[model samples]
Target: MRVDKYLKNSRLIKRRTMAKKACEQGRVIINEKIAKPGDEVKPGDIIEIKLGTGSTKVEVLSIKDNVAKNQSEELYKHLKGF
Candidate 1:
């Protein structure tokens, strides 16, 4: 799945546009490198999102086209948040 779509589908960023913007601005990193909105993401890949205060790291667990709100957290495993 595309990183932006994965982020939205997983409810990590809440919106695809925000995720894409984040990528464009280099706030999203994949496997330690900056990511583009169209970058491919797969299970087991590490994703790091940098926010104003800190950053969050997660390991992709699964990918899906659509996910329920209650099941969104299953898509990725939180590795660290600080």
Candidate 2:
């Protein structure tokens, strides 16, 4: 899935446009490198989202064709390594 779509579908960013903007501004990273909104996502990849206070890091655990809000978090697991 595309990084922006994954973030939106997973409910991590609230909206696809927000995710896209984040990526455009270089606030999103994959494996410690800046990632574009179109970046493909896969299992075990690390994703970091920059925010005002701190950034959020998650490990791609699984990818769903589509997910519900209650199940969105199952898409990625939080990482303490960040």
Candidate 3:
């Protein structure tokens, strides 16, 4: 799945546009490198997101076709390091 879409479906960013903008602005990283919105995402990939002075990091646990709000957390596993 696309990285931006994965973020929205995973409930990490809440909206696809926000996630896309984040990626375009160089705030989102895949494998420690800046990633575009169209970047492909798969299991085990590490993603880092910069939010203001704070940041979030997560490991792609499983890529889903679609996840409801209740099961969104299953999309990715949170990582301790940002």
Candidate whose TM-score is highest: 1
Q: List, residue by residue over 1-82, the lDDT tens digit for candidate 1.
A: 8999999999889899999999999999999999999999999999999978899999999999979999999999999996
Candidate 3 lDDT, 1-82, residue by residue in tens:
9999999999889899999999989999999899999999999999999988889899999988768899988878888644
lDDT for each residue of candidate 2 in 1-82, tens digit (9 for 90 to 100)? 8999999988889999999999999999999989999999999999999967688999999998779889998999998534
Whole-model lDDT per candidate? 0.96, 0.90, 0.91
**Whose TM-score is higher: candidate 1's or candidate 3's?**
1
Candidate 3: regions farther than 4 A off: none
TM-score, per-candidate, Cα-based = 0.97, 0.93, 0.93
- The better candidate by lDDT, 1 or 3, is 1
- Better candidate number, 2 or 3, judged by lDDT: 3
Worst 10 residues of 1 by lDDT: 48-57
Model 3 steric clash pairs: none
The number of the candidate with the highest lDDT is: 1
Residue runs of model 2 more than 4 Å from their true location after superposition: none
What order do candidates take by lDDT, descending? Answer: 1, 3, 2
Output the lDDT of residue 70, model 1: 98
